[model samples]
Target: MRWMKVMMALACLGVVSACSVVTGGPLVRPGEPTGVLEIANGSSHTLTVILIADCSGMSYGLNRLPSGSTIPPGRSYRFTTSAGCWDVSAGLAYGTTIYETRFTTQVRPGRLTRHTVTGR
Candidate 1:
């Protein structure tokens, strides 16, 4: 029956869909400016931004910035995204101990989260 097929499709979608429940009612809410997270790399080596969201089961995990994508030295990447988890942690992997930073507060709507990686 068509209804049966529709139900199955929705079930599959639900199994793959991931949502985040943030406190303070989400920064952006229903109608508001979306938040952005920007990262600047001043180190000599390329860097990658890895995000661990509260719950991410979608394709390629819940990474806002996928892996393999490199941010060359002296480059910056701005992620204009929204929150889908109650808590999110962002880390800058510079392929060395020279510099590293992790920000646990992330994906907040209506706000711009910024992180700069520099040599220690």
Candidate 2:
């Protein structure tokens, strides 16, 4: 009788544990959704953007660094970064000259930031 009671208790515990595990919703980091960076080229000539990003918070490591001279005019390039902060370095290519600039941004999840470059 004691062995039967222990087996019944163990089975009940297992079922309860399984239910909790199975019914738990997806795990999302605090302030989830990540961040997006968009570079819009409004300059009349074809432009290229070389983007480098350094990120921190929530997820760690791995940032996209884009290179090569061909972003095209009136086009936008969008990339996602971590949901906290990013130090972005951009190199703009116009004609045969290259100009470099660096800036930092605090990013919130699901928000889009558009940085437009136009004129001389």
Candidate 3:
């Protein structure tokens, strides 16, 4: 009976630990000519985010996030872009743990444009 109790306790602990796992983050799709980026913060705290295009070194948009702004723990916010070469970065503050995604423009005639991006 003592061994059965120990196994029950272990099973309960395992279930609790599995429920505490963190999930959700930024997701970008590159196959579309124009599309939006979906960002979800699953942590217990709010996250300030700045999104920028790597080519021009300009920020496309900014958001001062509050808890439950996107969805519950598994929800998200999205940002759309026109047809162009660009990249995205999300971080806590000005420059901390920034994540990036680079994309290229669709080919066009009579307009020669090239973009080279270095990820950080």
Candidate 4:
């Protein structure tokens, strides 16, 4: 019976450890005279992503992604902008929670600049 108790305790521990928590964050990098926005998913399961961008009083861009888009646990995807100031937010679909970020584009004279966003 002592061995049975030990096994039961181990099984409980395993069950508790198997539960995973999901985390999401924004990542950015420098692109060619432009800016790239990246969102990172750090969880054991898949996540639904929504992207919204504020482009300097111009147009707002919206994107929706399905679950299992599979950013994986340690990977990132990039979003690029055409013009103006850029603000990006990413959140899980069917949820009100969101992460917001603001970044500027580096447009040089006579040359186009591109910025890249990374989630590492």
Candidate 5:
């Protein structure tokens, strides 16, 4: 009788545990409608750094280009990001000279946003 009762209790406990809601996977959700950003180096300098910040003024946290990578003059680089408003900053390689500083642009999903950097 005691063994039967223990088994019943175990079964009841299992049923109770199964009744509780259980969820798994990513704890945080991602932004919707990702888009692309195309930066064209229309200047005489090699494009080195690309910084992106959201409309809320929060930066995307780092340079969009990989280390040691650069877009030569007349070339362009594309970046995939969430669709929304952004602030773009582009500078010359190995110097403090910036051709485009905090240039605001809109990125739409399923669309390409093209921005050209001049030698200003």
Candidate 6:
């Protein structure tokens, strides 16, 4: 009976550990340096929406750009975040145009990671 109880406790511990994966644990642990993510607009269209997701997330959290703002062609925007890999998407003003060139780039500590979106 004791052995069976031990096994059950171990099984519960395993399940709890597995829950971290589904819970979206921290991408950058405490005390880690952050970096800059530069989204450069090489495409002719103005960018009205920019969303970024940490690799651990199920979906993009929110639009990083400020409300009523836009990034015109040849311009760029930067975000300061924990140094790690991220997925990025940028779209046009009407939300009808999403650049197919999705970004899965690595950001180094205290460095700049640039992902440029060009024409189709």
Tens-digit lDDT track of model 1 for 16-120:
443332221222336544677667776677665444333432222345555568677788777655554423333445446434454455556666676666645
| CA displacement after TM-score superposition, residue 68 of candidate 4 (Å) | 7.1
Regions of model 3 farther than 4 Å from truth: 1-33, 42-44, 58-73, 93-120
Taking the tens digit of each residue's C-alpha lDDT, what string does model 3 give over 1-120?
Answer: 999999999999887544332211222225635454445544433335534442343334443244434323334555554344544444432245544433534323223333322233
Clashes of each: 3, 0, 0, 15, 0, 0
Tens-digit lDDT track of model 2 for 1-120? 999999999999999756434432112335567777776776665555444333432222222334444556788777765566665545567668876555666667789877776645
lDDT of 3 at 18: 47
Q: Candidate 2: which pairs clash?
A: none
Model 6 stretches astray by more than 4 angstroms: 1-30, 94-100
Pairing residues by index, what is the TM-score of model 6?
0.69
Instruction: Sort the predicted structures by TM-score, highest score first.
Output: 6, 5, 2, 1, 4, 3
Task: Give the per-residue lDDT of model 4 (tens digit) for 5-115.
Answer: 999999998775443111111122245244444555553333344444434333234343444563444556655444344544444322364333334443333333433
lDDT of each: 0.54, 0.58, 0.43, 0.43, 0.72, 0.77
Q: Give the winner by lDDT: 2 or 5.
A: 5
Off by over 4 Å in 2: 1-33, 55-69
TM-score of candidate 1 to 2 decimals: 0.50
Cα distance off (Å), candidate 4, residue 104: 9.4
- lDDT measured at residue 73 in model 1 versus the true structure, 0 to 100: 79
| lDDT (10s digit) by residue, model 6, range 25-87 | 444557878999999988878887787777867766566788887889999999887898888
List per-candidate RMSD values in Å: 6.5, 12.4, 16.8, 17.6, 12.4, 5.7
In candidate 1, which residue ranges exceed 4 Å CA deviation? 1-10, 18-33, 52-63, 66-68, 83-101, 106-109, 118-120
Please, what are the lDDT tens digits per residue for candidate 5 over residues 1-120? 999999999999887544331211111128578778899988788988887766564343456688889999999999887788877878775376455545889888878999988756
